[model samples]
Target: MKPRTLAGTCVPLCLLTAALNAAWAQDVPPGVGSESASRAGGNRLDRVELNSRQQSDTELRRKSQVAKQIYGRDELDKYGDTSVADVLKRLPGVNVAGGAPRMRGLGAGYTLILINGDPAPPGFQLDQLNPAQVERIEVTKGPTADKSAQAVAGAINIILKDAPRVSQRDLRLGLGYNVDRPTPSATFTLGEKLGPVSVSVPVSVFEWRSLNESVTERYAKGTDGQPSSITQQGEVLNWGHGFNTAPRISWRRNDDETLNFQGFAQKGQWNNRVRYNNSLPVGMPNPEDDADNKGSWRMLRGNLQYNNRFSDSQSIELKAGIQDARGTFNNLNLRSGLPRVHSVGDNQDRSLTQAGKYSQLLGEDHSLAVGWDLEWRKRDETRTTTLANGQNQLPDFDGEPFGARIERQAFFVQDEWEVSPQWSTYLGLRYERIATSSRGGSESVRNVSSVLTPLWHINYKLDPKGRDMIRASLTRSYKAPDLGALLSRYALNGKYPDSSVTNEELSPDRVGNPLLKPELATGLDIAYEKYMNGGGMFSVGLFHRRITNLIRNAVTLETPSFASAPRWVSRPVNFSRAQTSGLELELKGRANELMPALFDPKTALNLRGSVSFYHSRVDALEGPDNRLDGQQPWSGNLGLDYRFSSMPLLVGGNLNFTPGYTTRQTQGQWLDQSRSRSIDLFAQWIFNPKASMRLSVGNFAPLDGQSVTRLSAGDFTRTERSGRSWVGLGLELKL
Candidate 1:
């Protein structure tokens, strides 16, 4: 079915289901068929039945006071995914773009990513982390006082594996196919308890390769008002290998206090080669181009946490962390009838963090928490560009080291109150200040910003059992400008020579603005959630955000201090105000319960799906297509899993779709992206409880091609690019 028609049908159906469930929930007695009741009777029962991963995950979501979703081991191991990005793409209202996860169709920087409740380090790649190292994933739809208030769309927290009470060991081996070669990957996890200490370590090694093809066409008016056109065909080959490990240790000091240490390390290298052939209409010789790029990065971080419970109603926790990361990159480009250009760069980053939180219980219905967070980070980088003859490309900036420092401090207080058995509320206030300083050559720039944010959330149980509920939140969130955007530096366009004065709008030189301010937002969210029997759930949510000081790059022709002549330069600026709103619907349940007439009542079949619609407008830009950059109009996914009754086998598949959309970046510039569709399938053969094999196909269908177009008064340029897919086979062991 068409995406529009499907969206129209699904929204109404989801709302209807929520209404029916709410009505039915009122008649059911409190705790009649709840998980707590099933485990009642002094914690002793005639028979014990362990909850499945799905059931446990559902319960966690149902119990959360705020709107959140929990994905446990079941999701991590569902398709034998080697990367966390692959696993995240199937989540509801979430999508992966440029190796980063976007929430609610918003682009990167909108979703705040956290590791073990702490903000992830800069330059961290989610695709490099193995899913086997994760214990669970938590997705919160709004900002909370305990966490950083940088989430303008939402937050996703990656909880690494923790020490286990019982000794455990597991290993996984996999082989993947992409392009014309086969790649191998492996992961191993070990956990043990010794005396008063518990330790767990998970390590993974993986390799990947892909080849993408593209065709570019450009049309522009020459000096004589005649249109000149050029077509270029290009190919890029990329390959990489990486390894990462997360080790955790817990030391239990009696029943009232505990200490923990967690360490994470990752190292990786990637190489790519590019070649392009130009086809001109006039048979004129075009610049022959060939480029090679290589890069490597490494990170090491460690954290220590301490917890103390002075009394039953009071507790305190303290944490300290340190991180060091380094990277190196080199690139070489060769052009016909031109000098060969070679560039190399090195980067190093270091950070220190300290945080503390204290909680107190007020009477029996209210819990209050106060916390403080402090962090300091510094980055040092050096780059040199030279010709094959050993002459510096840019004399003023060559071989010079530049650096930036960021310091952040925050204080927050929150209270959670159980007003009554049927209602709960959260009230929080936070004050955060960020200071940044950048130095390049003889110029130094410093910026400081502070914000005070207030957040409120409330939940109402439709029935006494809490099977059906309503959640609403009013929050103030902000997106801070990154170090790169705040740095005052000049980066010349590679397509044209540095000494050339002529430049095109599509290939403009880039520069940063040290005066850019953070984007602040006021958000409202409302959701209705209904939990059904047998690990089923249905939720419909609506969200709206009013944003001020939106940051966007503005292009203009100018001659700066570093430039000798006028050139097109794109610099970051605080654009006009913008607003966005969306509707999200999610439904997951057993086929027998959701559609009894279409399937057998006892069939072991499960179904899950989600659809989201979004709309946005920038007040500074004129219509017809003045939406937010990279935000699609609609997106959805459908998935199913079936277990064979007569065999030890399970099969599942998922289909994801996002329609094409256009964005009017400026009055004279436009960008368009093609529709995207992906299909993934997996089959598992269970030999026993401890061993299994899985065969999976990711992006089974041909990859979707994308196109981008830039328009001017009499000039236009368009580029079309193709994609690739992969397949894998994996063996999992529990010993």
Candidate 2:
């Protein structure tokens, strides 16, 4: 059967919502999932007991010293998101394109990701995490003195659940089905408390599958209108699976000292099968190609921290951690029934960090904090390809077997002062230095960089009740070139020696620049917020950023090699300057407080909406009209949730939209994308105090991302579309 069109996909989700409303209009029991012939309803409980935990959390975030937003467990249940990336997509001004989260139109490199206030290791995959293991999520748009100065756009901190005060066991079982495939997931958690010690172990396994199709038209143009053509079409099947386990232990030695240790490990794999057929113009030759590719990755991390409380308002913390990650990829290519070629690639990364912090109360209205951080890292990467044809072996690129060593040190101090009853401010400064060396074969390069950053934030309350406030901040941040980019490396998979074939003569993989500088940015932020009772808030914020020494890909040389002919050597370079500015508006409150206020006193209803608009200009290859790479023009998020007072049922849904934008590529090419959208619907039943069941239809109307790439030389256009959607059912039980 053919897949449904976009319009056809929306009908079922709309009908589902309509059915829910029709049921609410009928006289039915309150708690039962079954339906009688006439009208089935749930029985009312004895009393109207309301728990406002979620509301209270929102209030706390609004009053935080720094500008921030929070998402609690209630929001998690409503959206039924499986991964941190999915959850972050619902926040204000966050973009998750191609399965990675971006903030304020900036890509992942500019946004810092943290776990429990510590930086997540490079190459850490957020999708491997189970949402059930999180207590809350905090999103800060700018860096604070306490955190690193690497976040140019913002930061996201994921706080995991703390050890239970009492012994506890939790089990979650989940099953999902796409129209084309089935998905299975499960998680188990057990916590134990023994006197002064507490420990918890959690494990999870998840898998998913998807299908994609693409078409490309290549044209050879001349001064005349007539053009020669080549058409290619392809389909790919992708499947992935992951298994993760984390164990944490905490020790409390009286009330003055504490120690905590945590360890995490995960293994993930992805497999893809591609089939393609190409048709050539009269004189040109075309062939059918097929390939099977598989990639696997493993990660391990350990953290240890000790905290000591010297006095009422004086404390110190020491932390140490290590993380290691490895990945491997293998592919077998078959072209036009020729001899098969096998290719292999490997990557390894190891990192260690040590940090210490001390905090003291200077006086009645001032607090000071000082911290130091040190990090060491090493990386190794290699790739190899072999052909089955007799006496047809080719030498690898010169930059194979790449390696890098890096070291970073930083020191920061911050002071928080409450000068008056209505005014509070924070002042801080940080100095950071980094040194790196890269070796490819026998050649090597080294680099060193240092920067000093200063940050300030001030908050002014207009009234004694703290109902209205103005916040402003100024900060500086930097983004360093990654290890792989600085280390010269290349892998030529399809090309071979002494081959004149046009299509197979594609460019060889080449890394050029061994010496690259970090990008720098200066930014400003101002916001106004109005707070209402019961955790309601309306906010408007504006921000501006000026970036210098923008890093962009540049072609350094074009030459033929023993392995691949007609190859280009490319490197990242400091190209130009860019300026970006935007505005954001957000609203969060109870549904009953929004329009008609129609819900019962005991019922829980919540609504949240956020929208962001931005524009950026960059001076680069595209001339003065160029915009920042991968920057979206606009994005928005909306959500609604309701829990009935007379029943054990909960219903909610969310929508996320990002209008597409286009960008120019390195080789006189341009790419365009259509608007993207994500919708999710969920209904949960609280069977009892100890057990619950949830049914969720995620990506209910999943957007079909259509990307078109146009080349200038041959006037070629490549169009591709990929879609993702699924339905899931889960059961949770506590003991």
Candidate 3:
């Protein structure tokens, strides 16, 4: 179905569901819907009884010194989302593209991801993480001195569950269906408290299978000025299984001192099979006719923290951690005339970190904090490719090993001061330094960079009760080049050597530049918030960023040291300056509180909606379609939930949409993407408070297909792909 038709169908169904539920609620007896009603006397429970999570989330947001959005257990479990990416897509001003999360319409690397107040390690995949293991999610719109200043757009922090104060046990069993088969999943959580020690462990195992269909068309002109075209249709089968566990132990020596340990481990494997057929073969044969691929990855991390307080006004915290990760991949491809091509790759990474913070409360209005962070990381990688006869595909770099190391240090200080009953301010400064070195074959490079950033935030309360406020911030942030972008190594194209006979602009060789500099940004943000009774809020925000020394891949014809002939090579370079701005608006509350004329004054209905607009431009690019890469012009989300007054069930659904947009990649290249839409629905039945079951459907009315078009000077390529929706049913038990 078309995207617009699907959206039109799903939105009304959601509103109809809520309207029907509200009508039924109007028939409920007055005393039965009151808070003090007795269940034994056949009285229905009040809507307030189901608002614990909402109340807690709102209170936390209201009391925070920094402006942020918090999502608790309710948001995590409401849609029965299996992955963190799915959960984040419903948030305002956030989008998930290619399994990575983006904020304010900016692409990946603009948003910083953190786990438990620390940076997420390399090779972390948000889609592999289960929501059950998370306690809450925090999203900040700007940079802060206490953390890294790499957030040019924003930051997202995932807080893992901690040791509980009471002993508890819980189990979850689930089954999901996609294209061809049913997949199974299970999770178990245990928590215990003994004297001064507390322990908690949560483990989850899951499996998935999916099928995707794709069609590709390519058009190009030959030396004779004759246009040629080729069309290929293909199918891909993907299967995966994974397991993850999080464990925590806490020891409280006294009220003023504590020690804690947190550990996490994950392992997973995936397999893929592809089959392709040429419907119209008018040009040279394709290199990737049929393929088989398999890969495996694992990660382990452990952290220890200690905290102490010398007096009512003085406190300190120390943290140390170690992490190890590894991955391997193997691929086999069948060609038309040549022998089968086989490739293998392996990579390993290790890192260590230490951090500390000291805080003191001065006379009545000011609180000060100082902190430092230190980290070291190393990576080793090896890759080899050969024909069936054991002949090296690219003889120059085949079977070669590469290594890289990075060292980082940072120090920051911040103070929060209350100037009066209506005004509060935060002032901060941070200094950071990074050094990197890499070696491979006959190439070695080293680079060092340092930055000093200053940040300020001001909050003004419009009312003495502090229920309404305005917030403004000005900060400096930077995006540093990743290890791969800094390493001076050459990566050849698939099944092709660095020769002019087969090289093309669209299929270019890749190399890194060691001399690249970090991209720095100056930003401003303003927001207004109003808090209402019963966990309701209305907010609008605006943000702008001006970035210097923007990093973008530039494709050009060059003869590198590794290649004998002039070939098309794409390299990362700091080429231009850019700017981006956006406006965000969000409203969420009980339906009756938002629209008392339409809904009953005490109806058990809830509503949430948000819309955002984004605009950007690159100073070096041409006019019209010169927006930031992968950024949509606008996006929006609408969601609703209703509880039946006659039954022990709750139903909710959400609709998300992103309009299509085109991006001007370079002087001669342009990229276009199709609109994206998704509709998710869930129903939960509460069988007493200790047992429950949930039924969920994700992407209920999946679009028939999505298309992408890439246009370059005499060449054009377009790809369209389609996949099926998924449904899951799960049961939960608590003891």
Among these predictions, the greatest lDDT belongs to 1
Question: What is the TM-score ranking, best to worst?
Answer: 3, 1, 2
lDDT of 3: 0.82
Structure candidate 3, residue pairs in collision: none
* Decreasing lDDT order of the candidates: 1, 3, 2
The residue pairs in collision within model 1 are: none
> How far in Å is the alpha carbon of 384 misplaced in model 1?
1.1
Q: Write the per-residue lDDT of candidate 2 for residues 643-678, one digit (tens) a residue.
A: 654566778888888887887645465667778888
Q: Using Cα atoms with residue i matched to residue i, what is each candidate's TM-score against the true structure?
A: 0.91, 0.89, 0.93
Residue-by-residue lDDT tens digits, candidate 1, 1-735: 001223333343354346435644554323336555633421221111112567789999998878999999988888999999999999999999889999998878999999999999886789999999998999999999989999999999999988999899999999887666679999999999998999999999999987777887777643233556777788888999999999999999999999999999999999998888877753332232678889999999999999999998999999999999999999888775344878899988899999999999998989999999999998888888887788876777878888888899999999999999999999999999998888888989888999899999999999988899999999999998877676666777766545445566677788778788889999999999998876778999999999999998889988877667777889989998999999999999778678878987546778999999999999999998899888999999999987754444568999999998999998889988888899998877655568777877777655546667677565566667664556677889999
Candidate 1: deviation at residue 636, Å? 0.5
Q: Which stretches in model 1 have alpha-carbon errors above 4 Å? A: 1-51, 221-227, 280-288, 336-339
* Deviating ranges (above 4 Å) for candidate 3: 1-46, 221-227, 285-287, 336-339, 495-500
Candidate 2 stretches with Cα past 4 Å from truth are 1-51, 220-228, 279-289, 337-340, 388-400, 493-512, 555-557, 560-565, 596-604, 621-625
- Give candidate 3's TM-score: 0.93
Q: Summing lDDT over every window of 10 consecutive residues in candidate 3, give the lowest-scoring window.
A: 1-10
Evaluated with TM-score, which candidate comes out highest?
A: 3
Prediction-by-prediction clash tally? 0, 7, 0
Residue 75 of model 2 has an lDDT of 64
Indicate the residue-level lDDT of 584 in model 2.
Answer: 94
Alpha-carbon shift of residue 274 in model 3 (angstroms): 2.1
